[model samples]
Target: MDFDLTILGSASATPMLGRHHTAQVLAVGRKQYLIDCGESTQERLIEQKIRFSRTDCIFISHLHGDHFFGLFGLLGTLHLQGRTEPLRLFGPAGLDEVLTTQLRCSGTPLSFDVQFTCVDTTQHQQVYEDAAVTVNTLPMRHRIPCCGYLFREKPGRRRLVKDLLPTGLVPEQLQALTRGEDLRDDVGHVWLRHLDVTEPPPAPRSYAYCSDTVFTESLADLVRGVDLLYHESTFLHEMLERAVQTGHSTARQAGQLARLAGAKQLLIGHFSSRYRDLEPLLEEARREFADTNLALEGLTVGL
Candidate 1:
């Protein structure tokens, strides 16, 4: 199975000529999960050649306009395209009410169902699960109730050594071996051991998305050992005071958190429009975490 992430927008608060707002697509196999649909996200998705109908879920970190304002337009476009599949949405408590009111005011009846799940921003808990992946909420320190999302791939079945298997083994016995179970005879005598016939599966991969949040050491514990960590870096260290005052993080802080969490790779974005050149921010983060990368529009990273 292939796991990848595509950056749609990276600007924070305001949209610029070259940069848009915050939005990303995490693709696990054929299923696509949209995170933070900021303004013009649908346009970005189209630019990336990702189908709107392929989105399996949408996750909004908070009610901030720069994070969720694009959702309304995306929903309306889906309806116009005559989509009938239900879309699962996870976000803060007031999201459902806001969405409902918007549709009502616009007099636009959706062609598909929107299944909303309110996320508790204060608790770290499992919010979604399927055969391929599991999603958990990571509490964040923001001006409003906000949370990050952690996505982890499920471990696959052990690989079978076909040449080592016995000739008379039944289908059920082979299945048991793939599941790392010992095969036994009707009399309960062990005939084959899983360890002898199978190799361990590939280790699961994990990605954590930390939206607008203040510098907090405690966040490292929640995303410890993550394969990829995408943290919002709204300003450089020179504007650290402004970052703290607005409950936003600096690029240096994002790097520090990634280093403390032992993350394999760090993606820093959600940049403030004040800086025209982003190389300085990248340099600031790389001082703490060498594997840091900038989240640019239409850039896709594989995990």
Candidate 2:
């Protein structure tokens, strides 16, 4: 029942001290998703003590170098380590060609199979779904084709309260009760009623990831009432002009999005190198959204 977000890097375009680039690891149960594998993410993963073996799926926001430059090396290392499990990667168009070129030039033969899927930033569509979770893409306001991700956990099956069950019920009978299935004796009779034993599944919990993008009001509904939101605050309010010029958002802008979307909490990052201190940015965002928090490396959040 533990979900966490570990920041691998937090700098935009240019690298800086104490900050690497844009990378995040979202841990949901035994699954780990690497989001935006910027340069140095592998090292950061090792440094942060995140288990690389547990990572099988990765989501990339766009084709920017700062957003996914670390993919090649990380994939190469996973191969060198003799990994046999399949790894799935989701990103924008042309990403497959780019990585394929790199792999060809580097001659890095992988032991595990790698699957790549391109995300259509312009479409509001579900990209991946399984029994455990569903991953969807949100159209974003960026200079290039970019998208955000929304992870929604699937509802759990009805779990029977074991202690409340009638005594001496067979284990198979208990499973049938949990599945809302009726049982029959050798003489042919109803053993369990769906209404008497099972309850509805719990509501799903969700997390939304918004990468480098402007604060566009159109996205408010797509991420409305999300449990947690990771938004890019590349500049402060004073740098509104720069933010507009660069397709970035100010701290206040990020806060406004969080507020309008009705998100429970906001984690802000993807800071510009010009800013040395982040306290002012945090202050500016916190002023508008009290649940706002700075996104730092190794900081984990329960989704």
Candidate 3:
């Protein structure tokens, strides 16, 4: 039930002031999955007290330097730290070549193996899966081939109420009830109903990530009804023309997408360096969608 997202950096295009770039950590239970290893992500992880060894999977949205510039450095640091566990990486095609070329030129071989999966930016497909969650790619319209990620938790088994259990029922019978199945007694009579003995499982929660994309209505269907959504708002409404030209979104546009997608909550970030104050962006988004928040560094949102 430990589902939350922690932001590491939230700047866009260039690093300025105290802001670095784009990176976040999604923690589901004890496992941690990294999303977009922007510059200084390794340091941020250490600063946040997140164990790098616990991170088994990484998802990179695109080949943009601000999105993945820290990956090679993190890999080399893991090598130096003597990490032995293999890491699975999902990213757009050519990422493998980029990383391999960097490693080869530097003559630094990692101690652990990096299993890479090239993602198709044009398709909405299942990219990664485990016992806890499933990740799907969300096709995005960006200046380059880019995509977002949808993280959906798996449904858990029903919870049994001990006081409601029948005395004669054994562990097997209880387990069956937990799985929403009815149990029969020796005489083939209905001994216990699943609904009578157990409570329904907790609803699965989801988080969607969208960044560096133009304002596109089709994105609404891709991330529909997520518990929480993180979308890039690199500019304000006054600069809508610039947003379109650069393949980025304005704060109002980000909120519009969240509203259209029926998201429970919207977290907006990737602010342009020109703005010293971010309240305008937040206010603009809130005007369109009341449940909106700024994606600041070190902020954690629980779902």
Cα RMSD (angstroms) for every candidate in the order listed: 1.2, 2.1, 1.2
Model 2 residue pairs with clashes: none
Predicted candidate 3, C-alpha RMSD:
1.2
lDDT of 1 by residue, 232-288 (tens): 999999999999999999999999999999999999999999989999999999999
lDDT of each: 0.94, 0.88, 0.93
lDDT of model 3 at position 233: 97
Q: Write the per-residue lDDT of candidate 3 for residues 148-212, one digit (tens) a residue.
A: 99999999999999898768777887788888999876898876789998999999999999987
TM per candidate = 0.97, 0.93, 0.97
Ranking by TM-score: 3, 1, 2
Model 3 weakest lDDT span, ten residues long: 165-174
Q: Candidate 3 at 180: error in angstroms?
A: 1.4
Q: Is candidate 1 or candidate 2 better by lDDT?
A: 1
Q: Local error of candidate 1 at 16, Å?
A: 1.0
User: What does candidate 2's lDDT look like per residue over 91-207, in tens digits?
Assistant: 999999998888788777788888999889998799998767899999888899999999988877677765556778888887777677767778989766645766766667888
Tally clashing residue pairs in candidate 3: 0
| CA RMSD (A), model 1 | 1.2
Model 1 stretches with alpha carbons more than 4 Å out:
168-171
